[model samples]
Target: MHRTQYLNSVNDFIDWFASNLGHASLFAHSYIDRRSNPAAPRTLAFTTLFDACKQYHWKHNGAFGSPAGACLQTNDAALSALRQALQSAINTVNDSKTLTASSAVMSWGGVRAGNVRWLTANSKGLAQTIASVCAALDSDNLSHPVLTSCQPLRFNAGMTKVYSLLVNDFIIYDSRVAAALGWIVVKYCQARKLPAVPRDLAFPWAPAKEAANARLPKNRDPGLGNYHFPRLISGELHAVWNLKAGWILAEVLARASHNPFRNSSTVPALRQLEAALFMVGYDLPLNVSPSGVNSEPESYAEGDWTECYTAARGKLFHYRVEEGGIRLLDGRFYPVAVINRMLIILVELFGTDPFPLANSATKVRVTPSIPGIGYAYFQATDERGNPPSASALAAVLHELGVLNYTPDNRAPWALDFGDYVQRGRIDLEALLKLESERHDDVGELIA
Candidate 1:
């Protein structure tokens, strides 16, 4: 397909989808208010696209954008209309005649402002090349070398799987999504607009002091713990102590009194926040023993740990301090979903933008510290200074448990295109190959 046709299809699809999404948002608000509870309409605000699909009626073979979509059924008329709209939008883009060419122009203008550059390799070594020479003859200011040499460039189109499977495609990565949703609600309230009953609206639960204290006890004494608790002192005495004990000590004292943990009131709020995230279809463990901690404390034990765990459905979090800039920690790397969920919620309240390319349609999600993939290992120098063998690399990752994700990497691409046989998410044939499985659906759903 031609570039112009491809762009037109994509633009049209976005227009249709965005328009339908606006209506869906309003319908969702009304559905929550009328059917569930009138007072706490915002309770269902974070319902995911998948959750919405299930709540309404959406049927297909697998994840969104998949071709086997006609199999699904829904009894609800309005929901059926919405699902059809989404499917039509996707179909219009995929069926574009302009994108038919095997090799199409890949524009980076949205991301790099025409100065975009990527490394290219050859038998000799990697030499910086422009995208213009790599493709057909194109504008110099707005293009790079044409990247047509197959073995020389070493292009792998399959890398897109990671972007779709790991990254959250929702535009909500930026605060715009939440702000837009919130704006809809605020407008409804201001205009006294009410719609039909909500299907799952209820009074959003509030945390209680007793419940919060039950999970973690308050420590008034600073000496007994690593975190110090503050005590009241007069301004003159505080000034004198600050001068004598150093600025660090005085800062610690002030932080102990004001920090979220020391405040005590935040415990219940955290607990309630945890509960709400769980409700929104995130897989977060309620309570789990921290690694290396003994099974002695009331909160620390195997029995106390909840079996709740869902992979792919992890949380995204980003934070910044005066010293450190924006950093995102997607919780899928953790063994326990609870820890992941906690970090997710904690960051949402205190976190910044989750990833770069916050507004683009094709942004890559970074999987932090993934063993063997991100880091390069060179054990011994070859006569000509060559890289290590694949077998040696695999051995190193195996020893470090980098290759072995706790849930076992039954990822999306393997089923969709790899050797795994059968159809549907977690095809029965695929399960037969596994010894035991916890969250295979995680790969498909997240993808």
Candidate 2:
């Protein structure tokens, strides 16, 4: 009933991990081998796994942490370049000069770092604050704060690269790192037979292309009882979990030190484990159902969108609102006619985001973006302004007669729903009177 002690849980998980080094559940890794077709999911030696990840994520590779990790692609050269740029920015801040006058906004990790606009309010004390946190991490204080300090003192993903230069053993806590960490923690809890993921072990993950890549499933989130792990990772909680992960990983290296590791001395201790997790977290296959049920995509809609949509007129359907999406017995799914995703969400909940069949996750598994921007109003944000948890939502097919996704493997599926949903052409106010009600789980609905 009580919370699990952080160190104790780490110790327990380390021992268990050492014992089950070859377990398929935790380490079933897949990678493309030049010698053969992409390797199938199976048990792999931890060292072999790490090497595969390193090669997969070479420098400048487009893949997120390609091969294994962002850290893996990095070398002394890359670090030095980023570090020099960071120091130049810091030196300007130290001199109390406006950052606009220095190379404070150079790009790193494919994002702008030390943006002058972001630091306008927090420019004061920034150099000292950064120095203070650097001192903590320099002395191996993982709890010095990274995420919460990302914007204030510039500790974002790109900035994390600079901190790694300043600190002895710091891991970059990007979206991939967070996703990989959360996945591992979830596996640890499940293996330990814990009813819920303890607050100590609850590392939050930011939903990204990684979720849709089949590496981290959107459904494999936290929530066992009173404890609920958020799908989105934010600032303070990000720092807390980041440090906890550092602590656990540090101890794991200590416990596993006796075990033989391939290219043992190539990377540092904590980074080795982080890279392996980073590798496994990318493209991780879904756990097979015990009954051998084929894994298939299901609708994201919350309610029974299948019944004759005339009855669906009053029923409310939501997007990931609850366990199976929320449903109100007498409510409307679409109040206003919007475009792109909301239009998709409306059609989705109305049981109309269908194709040749029904209840499929998406026509294409990749995420679709609204064309031409200007729809930021539909975007959701956390209290701490972290990225939205539903960032990687799958695209649903719409029956816009005039518009259709280009018939190709990588179609955008973008559409404008202006006057379409409400104009009775799509029959939005008329309960989809023009469209056929489709459902896979239950029989098709008849009007």
Candidate 3:
């Protein structure tokens, strides 16, 4: 796509998605509301959404499934695992006196898996590089060659993580986003009759021989060597391209926010812009799933049994059977009969009788019972009995609907619960009272 067209498409999609934000039930509206809140910490907001994207991808693409096509035992189960992984990552950097610096290093270290120890060993040097690059980016000094200082840490993915963690100024650079930028830049150059930036610069994994030949020294280009484009030149080019892309995206979103046809109350957040670019880069489906219902089955049975839960009216209504087909309670037939047929085949293929139960001793279990529907529970707990840090706790509370949140037009609740928790606030009796009240409410509904 042309640069203008690409920008327009991304902006248009962001507008459309923003207007229909509530459709993705799993991405609670509170998360979106927090993203636009200036008071919310940027690192926490971005990381939460980033984590959500990973789960969203796994849920939709069957990424957690085994090679034999067996699905995850349950959506909640898979989400729990994802959350645990995130909490483990959070635990690694939770005590940093300077969260932004710690987050940048940890995020960089994460992408460079085998080099984490090395990265950690040279934390001071990595910190310097991150600080310099982030400073240069903020000042729009794309010509400063910031990546040159990042010597051993040359991977674009890690560098992008550093950039993303430092500020909301740059988009994460991956192969897909890189390709989208390349297409835009190439078209822009073509239209203007300017020299095209080399494609090998954008996609560094071009075959070694081809890359070598492309960078061969010429009489007109004496400083150039075979490895110049991939090693040095490409990094410089990427820095320039990233700056341009960021500005273009910001401009597009800014215009969209003010567009007369747009109906969203707030401008798109940087994370939302990144997500829009990601979708455009990967050519992902723009439409949110119909009603945000999880289509995956929770359980299945082989001989004379089947089990599953269907989401309806904001609740997961359960079903089970000891026969040929699922039997919905109260003679509640599936709205889509074809889906039921597909579930039978899925059940036969992936069913493992007696689904695994979560271990209760190690997890904080929250089970809520809906009237006339079955019980649903989720288990999570902080690592090492440590209270979650401010950001981590915010994410958890947001997920649990316990956080102070309001939609676009309303003022957010003013609460110092996070501060109180940090100060070792402990009201065991009050907590017990609250729990008792909650149980009483559930009991009333059940009765």
Candidate 4:
């Protein structure tokens, strides 16, 4: 893609998003009005839009049933309670009562409630610790106070609320937001044609090599393993990760501010950018089904079915079908019901024949020598009289190396039989005739 075109698209999207900010919240209000609204007390309008993006993501990913409201309610209650306790401790201190960490914990009625466990073991230092961090935060020196002073209560979940509420410049540095910033950093580097940044530098939330080893799939090393899966960062690294996250956010914002497309008068705030990057990194609506196509699987009655095919390397591969899914030769499993439906749709649209006759005898045979090209075909017998399972059909198509299914739905399926051209010129006329007969047979069966 052309860089200028991509940049234009990004700017256009940002403009559109900024214009629609009022739609994110329950009540329609301008960004300026919402920011100044004390009663509503909303975060930046971009944050609300980002939350909407996340909701769309969850719904598409089949996990939208989670209790989002309940989670928010609990967090709100905890933050409110903590603020009340902190105010009471401050009032007592003003009245000349000794405000020890233990006394503060007692003042809060105990550390067992809500997310107050960070003050349990370090109860003795709670009052001094928070005071020092707040002081450093006020002075714009968070590394020493927030990172080092707050030991058990690290920067992310522990001190984020305090800083974000008190400090005008502070932005939340939780795992999700950090991951999103990392993704943006990587993308920015790629767009600028810079050397790839270290994964650790980009994604601070990833576990260390030693910790990651245990979680990786068997027989896979760090280089070959899938790093897409999310892992929790250890507490030991939280301080460093938070520092790096903050730095990355600052750098990204600095770069974004320099963009000529950005309006200097109405440039997006760092928090708004943070929300946008979070949506980009996380499963948001844009990354989901942009098209109207429903890529998710439809219900299908499933049964046990097994099929075998030979790979390009001549190694035999087996697909064991169970329910709506299939287990590949490499032990990786995929749900093929949706894929099968899509394949059916494609065949219906293209008028191509679906392979593997439902009633054929169990055997593998090479197609009769065409004028130039020949192909291998697998014939499987089903005495149970059940139709070929979707997994079985998909497995056959995959073996042919001509069916392409992009799970993300970012692209449509493709069929490329060019490999046969290298062996010999394909007999297009005969192949077309055979396919025509098969399509007719399939059409008759459907009727």
lDDT string, candidate 2, 1-447, tens digits = 111355774667767656554343455445322122235534433334345345434222122121212345354335455456556656555634422212222222422211222333345665655566666555434344443355533444444544555555466665556655666666677767787766666666543221123332333232332334564333444444555666666665566634433355555656656656655544333334436553532222323232211111122222211122222233422222322334444344333232211112232222453321112213311111112211212111122121222222233234334344432345233222212111111111011
What's the C-alpha lDDT at position 77 in model 2?
36
lDDT of 3 by residue, 1-447 (tens): 233544453453335433333333322211122112446533212232223333221111111231211122332233233334333433353322222233323322222221232233344444454455666677655445554465532434445544654444566554334433333333333434545344422322111111112221101110111111122123555555565566555554454433322332132354444543342233211112235532321111111111222111112233322122223443433222222222232233223221111223323223322111011011112222221112222221222122222222122212223211222332223322332222111110000
Task: Order the numbered candidates by TM-score, best leading.
Answer: 2, 4, 3, 1
Best by TM-score: 2
**Candidate-wise lDDT, in order:** 0.21, 0.39, 0.31, 0.34
Badly placed stretches (over 4 Å) of model 4 are 1-115, 142-156, 198-203, 206-237, 243-447
Candidate 1 residue 306 C-alpha distance from true site, Å = 31
Each model's backbone clash number: 29, 8, 0, 0
Sort the predicted structures by lDDT, highest score first. 2, 4, 3, 1
Across 1-447, the per-residue lDDT of candidate 4 in tens digits comes to 222332343453234333433333421111222112456654333334335232221110001121222232332333344455555564454322212222222212211111232333344545555565556554433344344544554444434544443344455454335545444443344444545444444444321111122221111111111122133343424534444444444444444423322342232345454444433332211111224442321111121122353322223444443334445655655443333333333443333322322222322122332110011112112122122233344434443333432232323233333322112233223322332222211110000
Point to the candidate with the largest lDDT. 2
- The TM-score that candidate 1 achieves is 0.19
Instruction: Evaluate model 3: give its TM-score.
Output: 0.33
Summarize candidate 1's per-residue lDDT along 1-447 as a digit string, tens digits: 232333343343223323333242432321221122435533334343223333321122222232323211311222223234333433343322211111111110001101111110111112112111222212211112232223232221111111111111101110111122222223333334334211111001111111122323211111111111122232222212112112211222233322221233322222222122222321111212324232322221111111111123322222111111111122112112222232232233223222110111111123332222111111111111122222222221221112221222332111112122212211222222120111111111110
